[model samples]
Target: MSRRLKNNMLTTIAYVVVLLWLFPMLYMFLSSFKFESQVAVPSLTFTPTLENYRAVVTPEFFKHLNNSVLVTAGTVAVSAILGVLGAYALVYSSLKKANNIYFWFITTIFLPAVAVITPVYIVLAKLHLLDTKLALILLNTGAGIPLMIWMCTTYFKEIPGEIVEAAKIDGCSKAGTFFKIMLPLIKNGIISSALLVFIVTWNEFFFAVTATATQSATLPVYMSKFMTQQGYFWGKMSAAGTMVVIIPILIGFFTYKSLVRGLTAGSVKG
Candidate 1:
């Protein structure tokens, strides 16, 4: 085939793949505006209504939304701080077994949350932290740290050793150099990591469902209430899902450039 024809074929394939990927999200968006009676039928013939959106905006929904925001923010902040420090130490420190320590950190990421959840639950119960936002915050922060460390470490390693050496020779303390010099240079990586952590924590369901009850339930947990003995409240659930999706979408859109740059920074050594 000619090069132009091949390019056209590739573009068509890309569009098809994108539409397939977006189909479910598009369905959900359309379903959110559907009336309860029309939700049962998949056809697009029915008139759209606002009742589902209205139903999902109760005070309780707002409370759950607040809980989600708090937990996600806390998890991101804690994970970023600890991950940056840990990654820095692993890359820059002169410890004899730094590689071994880095490998150990990476191993934690492979362990499934379900495998360790029992012990975590017991510990939290003993600490009387169950059903509190703090419990979720701490759990998410710890869970997120491994990936954050991995990302930050990769980015940090890409920094030239000469820069760090220069900072040291200039009498900069390790902490000062990290905060003032290294962080600004890797700001994109940090923001990307924060966004990733926020998205993960925001949508996290297993820990939220297991560790929390009424007082600290997040948006995902709140949406679960739509399923009852009677049946699923499909319209309201769709509406809630749509609303919950907006924050992350907006964040990803606004930070798309930095996220792409940071994620791809150390991939190639050109």
Candidate 2:
């Protein structure tokens, strides 16, 4: 086949794949405005209604959403702050075992949540933190730290060692150099890490279901209420899911460039 024909075939395949990937999300979004009866049918010709959205916007839903925002924001902030410092130390410190330390950090990412949940639960219960937003915040921050370190460390290592040496020679303290120089240079990496951490914490279901009750329940936990003994409230569930997805989508849309740049930065070198 000619190169042009091959390119056309590849483009067609890409479009098909994109459509396939998007179909479920598109159907869910459309169903959020549909009636309970209309959800089972795949046709898009039915009239849209606001009842599902209305049902999803109750006080309880908002409360859970507020909890999600707090937990996600707190987790991201804590993870980013700690991750930056840890990554900087790993990259610039003189420790002979820095590589080994990094390897250990990477291992945490592979550890399944199920493996540690029992111990974590016991510790939280002993601390009287169950059903509290602070518990979720702390848990998410710890869970996200490993990923933050991995991403930020790669970005930090890409920085020129000469600049760090020059900063030291000029009598800049380690703290001053990190605050004034390194952070600004790696701003994209931080933003990217924050965005990823926010999405993960926001969508986290297992810990939210286990760690919190009504008082501190997040959006995912709120949506779970739709699964009743009678049947799944598909309409309301879709509506709540739609609302839960909007913030992350908006963040990604606005920061697409920065996220892409941050993720791809250390993948190649000049």
Candidate 3:
């Protein structure tokens, strides 16, 4: 085939794949505007209504949403602060075996949440922390910090060491160099890292469901309420799902360029 024809074929395949990927989301979006009775019917001709949205937006929903926002914000804030400092240390500190320490951080990323949930639960229970936003914040921060370090380290490594040296010679304290100089250079990487942690902590379900009850449940746990003994409330669930996803979708859409750039930032390192 000619090159132009091959390109056209590839484009068609891409479009088809995108449509297939988005069809479920499109269906759910449409279904949220439907009556509970019409949701499972899978037809597009009926009139859309706001009943599902109204049902989904209860006070309980906002309470759970507030939990999610607070937990996510706390996790991201803690993770970014610690991750930046950790990455900076690994890259610039004079400590021996720093590379080994960096490797240890990378290894933590592979440790599954299930591996430690029992001990974590016990620890939280002893501290009377279960069902608390602080518990979720701490858990999600631990989960996010490793990835943040891994990502921010790349941005740090890409910077010239000489720049750090220059900062020192100019009478910049270690903290001054870190806060005033190095951080500004990697602001995009930090933003990308924080955004990622925000998304993860916001959508966290397993820890939220297991550690939290009525009070500190996040959106994912609230979404589970739809699956009651009566049956799945598809219409209301769809509406809740839409609300749960829309914020993250908007954030990802707005910061996609930074995310893409940050992910690929270290690809061409020497």
Per-residue lDDT over 1-270 for candidate 1, one digit per residue giving the tens place of the 0 to 100 score: 899999999999999999999988888888999987788788877788999998999999999999999999999999999998898988888888998888888898788789989999999999999999999999898778987988888889888899999999999998899889899989998889888889889999999999998999999999999999999999999999999999999999999999998888856542
Worst 10 residues of 3 by lDDT: 261-270
- Please, what is the TM-score per model? 0.95, 0.95, 0.93
**Across residues 83-142, which tens digit of lDDT does each residue of candidate 2 receive?**
888888888888889999988989998888889899999999999999999999999988
Which of 2 and 3 is the better model by TM-score?
2
Per-residue lDDT of 251 in model 2: 92
Model 3 lDDT tens row, 120-220: 99999999999999999999988899888888888988888899889989999988988898888888888888898898888889999999999999999
Q: After superposition, how far is residue 96 of candidate 3 from its true place, in Å?
A: 2.7
Separate clash counts for every candidate: 0, 0, 0
**Per-residue lDDT of 71 in model 2:** 92
**Model 3 has how many clashing residue pairs?**
0
Give lDDT per model, in order. Answer: 0.91, 0.91, 0.90
Name the better of 1 and 3 by lDDT: 1
